[model samples]
Target chain A: MIHKSDDPVIRCDGVWKIFGARASEALDAVRSKGLSKEEIRDRYDCVVGVCDASFDVGRGEIFCIMGLSGSGKSTLIRHINRLIEPTAGSIYIEGQDVNALSARELRRTRAEKIGMVFQNMALMPHRTVLENVAFSQEVRGHDVRERTQTALRAIRAVELNGWEDKYPDELSGGMQQRVGLARAIAADPAILLMDEPFSALDPLIRRQLQDKFMSLSAEMKKTTLFITHDLDEAIRIGDRIAIMKDGVLVQIGTPEDIVTNPADDYVADFVAGISKLDLISAGKIMEPIDAYTRRDGPIDFDAWPEAHPNQSLDQLVDLSIATQHPIVVKLDGRPLGVVTKNALLRGIKGDTAPAASAA
Target chain B: MDEDTTFNILDPFSSIDLGIADSAGGIKQWAIANRDLIQPIKAVFNDIVTAIDGALNAVPPLVMLALITLIAWQAAGRRTAILVGLCLFALGLLDPNAWSLAMTTLAIVISAVTACFVIGLPLGILAAKSDGFERLLRPVLDLMQTIPAFVYLVPVVMLVGIGNVSGVIVTIVFALPPLIRLTSLGIRGVNPSVVEAARAFGASPRQILLKVELPLATPTILAGVNQTIMLSLSMVVIASMISVKGLGNEVLRAMGRLDAGKAIVGGLGIVILAVVLDRISQGMGQSGRERGQRHWWQSGPVGLAWRLTRARNETTPPVSAAPRTEVQSN
Candidate 1:
């Protein structure tokens, strides 16, 4: 059987999660009202936890679902894992319709192929760090020695070595997150789902863990779906960010695309006060260094400046114009190309930079 | 009096006189028929006398004191244990042979309490799970607990005809209610979150009972067991009336003989035994509470089991090795 390459590790298509009696009639009424937010809320005591939401996460992509509290970001992610069943429409996990699976099969799938990290860590209080990490395997009837080794490897990957004996209560919030991550990855699941896994941590610890998670994802290359209300976090870790508003998917795009050209006024307003420099990437502004550029003491390709990938395009444009020379585009001191004023301006104005072949 | 009235009264010719005479004849006939049934009861009385005699003749006073001291040392913690042991030793000095009878009574009470717990815990769990069952059982348990211990002797004598079996049966009925109530309360009081977490982990109902509910409720259940033991001890004095040989019988014997010192010593021995058992059971409950806060054993054993299972999973490669496909949306 042929499978589509663009297929998501988990897909929820036109899914509806309505919570009320006469839900079907209410849904019909909302549909007749063109499913406007106000009409849906009024017509049916329905919550519309996920309203006709449709999305897919590609293999190895860190797709983020972001929204304010009660906007259905968590609900949408849960639909993929089937933690909460959708009232209408279909969800597919690894090409098998999730709703079609028996309870036992679904449990098996959750244990073997998918792992979830909950917002509160959800570590079993009675279990220690090792037991928590190895729980899924244990449920699947894995023997002690093998699962322990697997758990240990995962713990090491999350940088939680030597804390295996400690209970979840003994660990700090950040350490608990590491344990949660280890537990999720211990089964070597194909798809890892996290629901605001770091939102409970201090900002600094959250950022640190976020970086660690990204690096781990890069290494393991597993498809990941994360839910969070933090936009900064979405930009920092998401390969593709999906913004949700009131149970509806508002927009889905790369962070640069979202920052430069928000799909709607709501999304634009959400990104409004954030510094544009923080949103522009070196790839977006880089241009070829031409003969018109003055050589500044043998342009050191290895010594290019570093900027946050999220820096505003305007800041890059101003910096380029002020520098009066093609700015070198480098990531960790390996030159990719250059950024001239024209190219930086084009990036700022939401116009594509003229193609210049890579060196 | 008229001559006819006096003659009728003397001749038993009236209706009331005939009825009384007939009832007296019936009583005589019933007693003769039940003579065989009454034999075991008579034997029990004889056995109690002989046992008390043997206890008085065979055991030295100091030995009984030493045995009491040892029991106290084992059951209670060191301080209370020591205090109890010393008290029993003093009692033995007053009358050593009575101490053996006292210890035997303590043994019977403890055994009766243990039996009550065995019967009560499962009933408690059932009650906690089913409201209808609990409602049905409530009135019955109320009757069992409220009826005086002495009242049980009459029916027991009619059925089993007076012995240790009858005595234990009464004690079980008297002491069982606390175990049932506390066990039910403990099971019901288990944390909801813990239960939810266990469910999410795919624990079956049986697993949930063993792993989550039972362990968490253990401290409370143990407390019930302690109460049952105390109640069983309370029944010992009443049990002696049924000819069950124990400290109660020795005490009764002393009171009959009007030996005040022997009665006091026997009563003190019973108190010492109760304190020892109470302290030990309480200590066990406290230790359980302390152990509950620590997860070292759970993680160690459960984690080891999980690890071994994972190893088996790896060695036996999955049969359905399809590169798990990702579902796409249009």
Candidate 2:
């Protein structure tokens, strides 16, 4: 579900962060001379942490920014809460410019509106699970009993009920991260900034937490800017993914948009290992019904198996195995297109040259 | 001054003097002039030391021993309590004057350490928060540490006058640097990500310091406290040369007379006291750090009471229930 609200929960406009004593000079060079990141680094002895990053996350949208290490994905997310101020441009949260807020107002916004989870979880080592989870609310001077109740509820939501009294060191890595999640949600903030929160876990535990976080976020309807270096994870959990490289956001689109049509060679290579079986929908691969009928004559729609236009390539494959005929892709009981075995194979192979039937 | 006549290039430099002694005299004069302001502060410190000394001496030696042992058992466990009990017993056996002298010395060290903490903690925190403060404080700490305690004794005695209070002032100067340095180190050593996490959650600077940073830095600060206590003990003895009372006086007298046996006894008393305090404080520092540890009540005096009540209630539930019902009816 893509959420498109007029007032985005987070909007980054031409945000730039160059790190070093000469950051402003480097940024100016980038703008005036159109210097590449390396050129700026070499000329000014500065590193561009984020270069002109701009994106809008709608209300309750799970917007994932994916990149390799040193790609500035983490730096970009931190700008939302004003943890790292933009060297240039502006960030707006719910139509209010974040940069324009006073120091007190910024802190209030962080406490009341945004909660973040760290890759290392960063749960206080001295505090018990319950205390760590209750900390955000406690810092806001919430009533102790009320915050405890809210924290316990969040702990339950994360399935860490019995381990509330345990210290962070006593917890396994996965459990500690669950405490991190619990800590973030306990505050009931509108936005959640998750910085590769599950990237450190083993694959099995990572998948489990991803599923848990996805459902919890959905139920709470939290607007999230999730950062990850893993493309598969972005595809699995993101409503829309922004692919970043060398401190620049290269592309922003839905998972299917990215996998089916990568913007450039870097993004294409990045998603090469990611399985597209589920991410590619029937709408992407189907030949239009008119095109199919023009080339192959009218189909006996009654004889073919019917599937929704939203059916994934994997589902279409399943249907193809169950029947000998092409599947008619339908929406609201009207045929939109046809997904023949040849077109399905080409889609699976990521070859989107119009199928012979489209000819 | 002519360098050529001395046949040395540096001869002219040697003729110049820094006049440090004059500077010291100037400070002494200034302090005397400001006696009105300084006197009340000295009197307050004097009263605090005397009060602590009196309170400690009020407790009979055996009772104090038992109390310390009880505390040790709670903080460090049974083994340390037994060891502490024996050490205190040995001090008594070693010197007839041990209890009274030790209490006086203990009172001085306690006051000095309390003063050090009061002064050092904020400075340490400031140093941790600001690099400029750290740079400013670091060199002063070095001078305080490297200056022979004897060298400062002259000025301290002159400025504060000769008394137990002056001795405490001296001990505080000697014992304070470590607490300040270690506290800064502890706070600075707190994981950066954890502090960031706190800030990300909208914690104010004060809240982050108190709730997140200090608690994480406790073990380290306790280690600093342990060092401060040891330093105070040693300085308390040195402070005795200026008419400060305590076991230090005994040691000083024994030394003047060259009485080997008496000197040994006094030294042994101080040694035993040092070992006992060190072990107890170290134990307190290490408490609650073990993996999967239970609540405080599960391990200390409170645990004993809880167990007794539970066992009695289990034996006669009706009797336990009767009291509650009576209270409710009342």
Candidate 3:
């Protein structure tokens, strides 16, 4: 919070995580020859965990990495914390080159700047919920009073105040996950790396924890790299989502961008099931207001239903249903385009920009 | 005789030499004379045994019996407690001075187990932490465990001479391997995910060892200690061959005089002791380290028995046993 530079909180350029004996050489080969993942694996006995991943996370944004297993999403995030070293590439956090940090400096950075939550929720069996939450502070050598207070505040944040003294076994899976989250935020670090933190919980609990996390994220505003395989979750939680396939970053865009204008069929198929209710905006589907006004007679601006450029497909549909006339999509309350019924339907059904205009 | 015929089994040129007694005796004399400064070290071993033996003997038999029974009850269960009490009582009835003899054996076992913990724990940690150390220790432990029990006594007797101390030394050597092996296994078996989590939180190596590895490995380490105690008990009778006085002395004398009754009684005493200690230690490991809750009524036996014996108080459940989940099931 103190350093309010416009620089992104986390930046990784050409981050490569190749796992094998000759990982460096394999990366070089991949860079020079553009080796396929299968070819690299077959030729060098190396698994390309992440093939040149590069992205920047805004200071307060939740950038979700969406991928199925073997997609290198988890491996990519670990590089940010130095939990796994990259074979090649540079990572900078707050303008400090992470790859250049010494071991001691890296440790301090992990302790002081970044916090992480994992799917396993590996709360120490011996430690109580409170002590587990206080772990990061303890690592940084915070005294008993300060750490306990910070830990308590975090436990409270996760709504686990009364269960502070309970061991992990005594708690349910969701509760354990809460303790894991509490542990991560106890230090109140600037960045968080959450690796499928709720994947193990039951669906009901998972949704509940997701809601809990969403609210907490808004309140804390910490830069988060959230890894998940579920497309719906990424779309729901991420400000911008990065999709990975076979160790390569296939696409990175806002949820709206990926949903409305997919980079390829792979991304299109991945987002096929996602509802167009929230993502497809009036601005994306609108026709030129000038030509429409010229063709039609003098139209009273206030007579017809109006919508903002950022209005979701659901909102536009509501507006379309309310009035006989076309919807005027506005940017900064100034008319930028018109969204007729046919154009709205086409926008909803088609990926290409409003395939045909409506009279 | 042929020039190379000395290789024959019956040849007298350093072959088929029946000088076992001479060499052993010579070695013993040289050892006692502190030829390699072995006697001074042996004296240190004597002091440890003496202190432990004195502490064990210091308490009265009835008090010790009650203490052991209570610990067994708390750590294991009512069944173990009952069994230990009955066994000790039978031993006391069988031998005129069974209490004293059992006390003497207990002293040696305690000393030996203490030594095992002191030496084996660090070695175990080292072996667990370092792959090279673990590899080095594997063969050494295998040898320590596999060697004949009597073989260790010979070297120990040569250095320390036949007495209470030498018996303890030999028993320690015989019993050391389990703690070492088990402790290393326990530490190494700590969940990798847990370790990784600790690392992610920026825990130093030392902090990780203390906070994560040790606590999770406690139950396994406790199991090792139990095994060490059992091995120590088994070796006590053999230890008495060198005149470490205890129930073992009774058995040894019984065998010499063909007294079956005394031998059976002595053997039974060792068995009962072994079972009692084993159940208690094993039970402790099963329950695991003191964690999570501190109930008002869980202030040891006084509270436990009161709670168990008293009519189930339905009001105000223990703090630790409180409902954990706040999320609605609907």
For model 3, how does the per-residue alpha-carbon lDDT over B74-101 read when each residue is reduced to its tens digit? 7766787888888777777877877788
For model 2, report DockQ. 0.73
lDDT of 2 by residue, B48-73 (tens): 99999999999999999999898887
lDDT of 2 by residue, A168-211 (tens): 97789999999999998888998999999999999999999999
Best by DockQ: 2
lDDT of residue B44 for candidate 3? 80
Candidate 3, superposed: residue stretches over 4 Å from native: A1-4, A102-104, A291-304, A331-334, A350-352, A355-359, B1-36, B77-79, B288-299, B302-330
Candidate 2 Cα outliers beyond 4 Å, as residue runs: A1-5, A293-306, A322-337, A355-359, B1-7, B10-12, B23-25, B31-37, B309-330
Residue B56 lDDT, candidate 2, scale 0-100: 96
- Please give the clash total of every predicted structure, in order: 31, 0, 0
Sort by DockQ, top down from the best: 2, 3, 1
Cα lDDT of model 1 by residue, B92-194, tens digit: 5556565666656755675577668789989999988899999999998999999887765665666556677677778889999999999989889987655
The alpha-carbon interface RMSD of model 3 comes to 0.9
Give the TM-score (0 to 1) of chain B in model 3.
0.81
